[model samples]
Target chain A: MYKYDTYDQAMVDARVAEFRDQVHRRLDGSLPEDKFRPLRLMNGLYLQLHAYMLRVAVPYGTLSSAQMRVLGDIADKYDRGYGHFTTRQNIQYNWIKLEDAPDILADLAKVEMHAIQTSGNCIRNISSDQYAGAAADELVDPRPYAELLRQWSSFHPEFSYLPRKFKIAVIASATDRAAMRLHDIGIEIVKNDKGEIGAAFYVGGGMGRTPMIAPCINAFVPLDQLVTYSEACLRVYNRYGRRDNKYKARIKILVHELGKKEYTRQVEAEFAHLLTQGIEPPLAELERIKAQFADPAFESGLTDSVDRSDPDFALWVDRNTAAHRVPGYAIVTISLKPVGGIPGDASADQIRLMADLAKEYAFDELRVTHAQNIVLAHVKKADLHALWTRLDEAGLSTANLDTIGDIIACPGLDYCSLANARSIPVAQKISERFAGREGELGEIKLKISGCINACGHHHAGHIGILGVDRKGVENYQLLLGGSEGADTSLGQITGPGFDEDGIVGAIETATGVYLANKEGEERFLDTYRRIGMAPFKEAIYG
Target chain B: MVEAQIRFRDDEPVGDPAVTADSFGDQTNASAVRIEPGDDARALLPHLDRIRLVEVNFPGFGDGRGYSAARILREAGYAGELRAVGDVAVDQLNALRRCGFDAFAPEVPMNPADAERAFATWPDVYQPTTDGRAPIWKLRHG
Candidate 1:
């Protein structure tokens, strides 16, 4: 983790004080509601359907065990004893009070965490692959550049009030675990033919009412010019992006309307001008940030063997553990999705327990996956059994990672002010229906969002369910063939929408079709893409 | 008494003698000109030497085109007074100043005592902007 210096601490402290004053002004009737709304939103306070919601940024999805404990403390002290980890690798407290928001921010600032730019039409929290540093196939640990971007975008004057919200994702691995292509700006750190590390820029890709897979604007930008090039991209969008209609205000609309070649040309023009101005940070800054992400000391002679005598522990080890770059180490995922329970909701006690487990078994660092699960990225193989037992006791040891049971869902109409129908109940129902069929489903990604704003990333799910409102009734539309991996593609909606029960049955029928038609060892997405959505649609609608 | 209105030129409040866009062409002798949110700032870049103040109107705080306008003027070497007029608040003061707005003419006057604290809130910033403040990166490397 990047340690905050005196300057960084001072900036955050100032922001907290500024927000506290704004809150006081709003309360004293000195500031009217219309003006106070934007101020509160910029600080991550939202007027939800029930209470004020605060979304705190977990930068690049990395958190210290101490930071996780603080989150648990916040949930217990302020919220309703729980917090929902979102698809954006953030945590939202649903029962926040308007008056206590500044205090919450102050607490987060103490631990070098914040809720800045978590909302509003600014550069949002920069997200990256949760397995960034520990994964075996990573080209580079992307957290350093992510931290740099986080700093650059924070309180940016030019891009702060963009036409619409801007999200950026960075990933170094070939597999896009962070849904990089679905972001407004996606960066893949790659090595050029000359062995120099650079960035591949993807612009205008997003998921919302208008879903787009960002096209490559620049194949390779030198490491030195990454910030300059990104600034150029945003500058073009800030000036030319449509603001007449809120729905069409995202950068995707501008790219779509201007055509990729023209948009790229404009960005290049801006990049040239910015380069002349010498806006790129000095090389020493990059080295300074990189030093913070150095690998922790590892025990070299440890055995790589895990005792698989216990069948339950073996199942979990196979399902929830991933290969690590370091020998005799593994990345362990703590599944938040228990069968018949809400996805991504961790109780205060569960959070504290996970925090303690990270400190004990892992290297005191944790990651929050975009799938809304916690990851212990540097766990030793020998500690698997003990960790599994502790996790099982805490009800966090569900051997259902990437299975039908591990569903990705958004807080839909149940809690969201913009949702048209309920999503959590739908996700719960679907997970319950597929409880014992994890093996049969075979690596299915099922995502559910309550509305067109695809917060659950339903557009990237192998079997996507979107809840819609039709004449005062709840309905769901099924989509097939969406994948957020290296081979990114949006799911195509099947036929008509179904009632809540009908949708659950539809998912079952679709899974049955996959089981019957799949080739040997093929994942659900592979099968869907190979056979197309026709069979699944026929099985569901027929 | 006249209505309380906040106005500034070069971070200091001069009289509210800024001319609106509708009257800007006629007031050729005016040193400061106020442009609406929809007006293009590029048009005034060529006249940078004569104009000492460029006031950009923000009809609503959410309408952020003015921020871009201020940046454009500054990048084009308009070192004159860059004042953000209309719908401005203390929350937006730091950003406006960063985007090269040295003054503010908020639609509603802010309490001067509170506004001073807001402007000096973040003495150091992480990214370099038109405000010319040395970013933390520069300070660290140097």
Candidate 2:
């Protein structure tokens, strides 16, 4: 976990004061709603279907236990005793008052957090592999790079008002847990043939009205010039991205219209110029940031074994924990997707309990997954049983990582003004319908979104369900073959849409096809790629 | 009615009407240039030494191409009064200034007190800009 320096702290505190004044003006009716909307949005306040939703950025999804406690406190103090972790690895409070918003920001500032760039058409909170530092397969920690980008993009004068919301993801491994190819700019830190570390730049990928897989614009931008290269990428987009229609305003559309070759040429030209301008931060700054993420103290020569004496504990360990790079540790993912519950909602008490567990059992830090789960990244394998018992007591232990039960869903028509249909009930129904059979349907990644905004990452789901309003009736469309990992692909829709129950039945039917057709040990995604969408569509539509 | 023009420098008064980038070549006497959102600021690169005023129009606050226009002129060695003229608000002052705008001629009359506050908002900036301000990173590691 990277701690804020004096400068970073000063910047965040200053923003709080700035926003406090803005909110005061808004409350006094001095600034009109239209004028205040962008200002509030810049600070991550949104007028949702019911109340103002304040989204707080958990930069690169890492939080200290103290920070987590403050987040829980914010939920209890300002919001309705709960917070919803979003697909972007940020958290949103559904009910926030205009007057309390500034106070809430001030509170977050005290904990080295703020809601800046969480909303609006700016470079949003930079995300990365949730398992960045602790994963066995990772080449190097990507958060230091992500943090550098976070600082670079924050209130960038030329790019504050981008054509559309821009997102960036940095992944060190080819596993792609953060859905690297689906971001506006995805950087995969890779080693060139010369054995020099650099970034593979994928520009202009997003899921909106149109979904695009970002193409590799530059194969190897020397890591030293990563920020300069990113700036060059954004400069070309900002100067040329469409503004006539909001629907086609994202960088994806701009890159699509310009073609990858022309875009690459333009970016290379700009990057060359910027390199001479001394735009890159000193390499020592990266070393400074990297030092903060140095490995936690581990007792050497600890055993690498977990007791499988209890079957329930064994099942939970098998499903929810990932292999840590260190021998004695495991990365434990606490499932927020409890069966038949609101997918990502955590009560204040539940959050506080997790924060305590992170301090006591794991390291004093936690990471939020894009799948809306919390991870104790450096838990000793010896403490697994005790940790599970504590979490299970608090109803936080649901052994559903990457299962059909671990569904990613958006706060759809229930809380979102932009959504056209409801998404939660569909996820709930499907989760409940398949909870008993989830073990048999291993590694099925299900995602749902109320609208085409794809906030639920429905486009990247192994079994994606999109809710649409067809002639004033809520209709659910089933999409299969999507995967957000190493082999990234958008799901395809089956024939016609279905009603709520019909969609649930359709998933059961679709999975039935997978089970019937799957080769040994093949995940739903693998079976789908091999057999194609014909079987799922035939089974789902028929 | 109050002072809409906030100039950083004492030099001014290019009495010749500012011409658009398209007409800059046509008018030899015009020492001032105006850039629309779509106009290439580089069009005036050849005439930067003589141009005393460069005004970039931001017809809408949300349209940010003007920022690029200002930066382009300044970065191309345009040592003149680069003005941001139109739909400018107090909130954008810090950013507008950072992008190399030394003068402002906004359409809406902003509260002078608020404008003063906005100008004094950040003592330091995060990114290096054409304004020659060292990014906080450079200040840290310089």
Candidate 3:
């Protein structure tokens, strides 16, 4: 984790005082409701359907044990004992009081966390691969770059308020765990022929009212010019993005309307102007940020050792652990999407426990995966048994890693005012439908969003379900084959929308088709690829 | 005695900015700035200095044109009141404020007491915006 320097600390401190004053003014009636709304949103406060919701950014889903403890404290003291982790690796307390939010932010800042950019039309929390440093195929740790972007974009004088909320994601691994393709700006860290690290830049990819798979603008942006190039991208969007209609205001819509080539040309033209500003991030500063992500010293001579006799441990190891770049280590994913439970949700006590586990077994750091799970990266392979035992007690050890049970569903109409129906119950149904059939469920990513805003990112799921309201009844539309990794592709709509009861039946039927027709050990997506959507489409609608 | 003003409530217009959306329709002070989708923006750029209050209009609640306008106005050294007129709500007040609006006009009848409570509700904040400052955490601890 990057430790906050004096300047960073001072900046947060001053902002707190400023907000306190704003609150004072607002309470005093000097600052009217119309005047105070935007200010509160910039601070990550939202007046939701039932109560005020406060969204706290977990930058790139990285958390220190201390930070997690602080979050736990907030949940216990102020909220309803639990918090919902979001698809973007942020957390939202759905039932917050307007009066307690500033104090909550104060609590978060104490641990170097805050809710800045969790809402509002500003550059949101910069996200990256949750297994950034530990993933086997990673080129370079993407956190330093993510951190650099976080600093540069925070309250950037130029791009603070965009046409809509802008999101940037960075991934350094061969397999994209960060969902780079679905972000406003996606940067993939890759090495060139000369062995220099650089970024593969993708622009205008986002899942909102207008869903789009970002187009490649720059094949490779040199590491040193990352910030400058990024500025060019935003400047282009800021300059030309639609402001006439809010629905079409996203960069994706702009790219869609202008066509990718023209948008790229506009970006390059802005890149020329940005070059004159000397926007190149200082090399020393990069080094400083890089130093923050330095790998912890690993115990030498450790190898992959597991207690094969313990069925539970073996099952968890096979399902939950990923190969680490370092020998004798593994990247452990803590599944929050347990069957019948909310996706990306954890009680305050659970948060504290996971924080403790991160400190004990996996270096003193934890990561929130883009898949809405937590990762204790750099867990020793030899200590897998001990880790598993501890996790089992903490209820963090779920054997379902990416099976049907691991469904990604948003708060939907339950909490979000923007949602049209309930996504949680649908997810619960799907999970129940696949219960005890983990072996049969196979590897298929199912995502659900309640409305067109696509905060649930239904457009990017292997099996996507979007909830819509038809004649005052909740209905779901299913899409298939969307992937957000190195081989990114958009999911296509399968057929007509299904009512609530029909959705689970539809998923079961789709899965049944894959189970029967799929080649041996073929994932659902691979099966779809080999035989297109024709097979599954027949299975569901038939 | 009240002016035929267009007020923002919850980031939306109380009614249409103009009686109709076709034109600005001259008023005593034309705070209703026209946002040409692909306009060069050079005209708005220079005049930003002279404007004491910049009111960006949102045709609907979901229309986010004002967000960009706010950013551009703040960046171009417009230190004036950035008010979001039309389709405003109490829910969007915090976001508008963060984006640089210092005043608000909720669509509902103005209640001075309720307005005061709205701003004072959140005593601490995080994230930097057009207004620069550290959140309360850094102040008390760091």
Give the least accurate 10-residue stretch of model 2 chain A, judged by summed lDDT: A533-542
Error of 2 at B125 (Å): 1.5
Q: What C-alpha lDDT, on a 0 to 100 scale, does residue A398 get in candidate 1?
A: 94
lDDT of 3 by residue, A49-133 (tens): 9999998999989999888878877888999899888888888888898777778878777878888777887899999998888
Ranking by lDDT: 2, 1, 3
**Candidate 3, fnat value?**
0.06
Chain A in model 3: its TM-score? 0.98
**Which residue pairs collide in model 1, if any?**
none
Note the Cα lDDT for every prediction shown: 0.88, 0.90, 0.77
Candidate 3 i-RMS: 7.9
Q: First chain of model 1: TM-score?
A: 0.99
Weakest 10 consecutive residues of candidate 3 chain A by summed lDDT: A273-282
Answer with 1 or 3, whichever has the higher lDDT. Answer: 1
Q: In model 1, how many backbone clashes occur?
A: 0
Model 2, A1-542: lDDT tens digits are 79887888888988988999888888888878887898899999999989999999999999999999999999999988999998889999999999999999999999999999999889999999989899999999999999999999998999988888899999999889999999999999999999998999999899977999999998898878999999999988888899889999999998999999999999998788778777899889999889999999977787879899998899999999999999989999999999898998999999999999999987799999999999999999999999999999999888889999999999999999988789999888888888877689999999999999889999899999898899999998889989888889999988798999999998889889999999999999999999998878877665
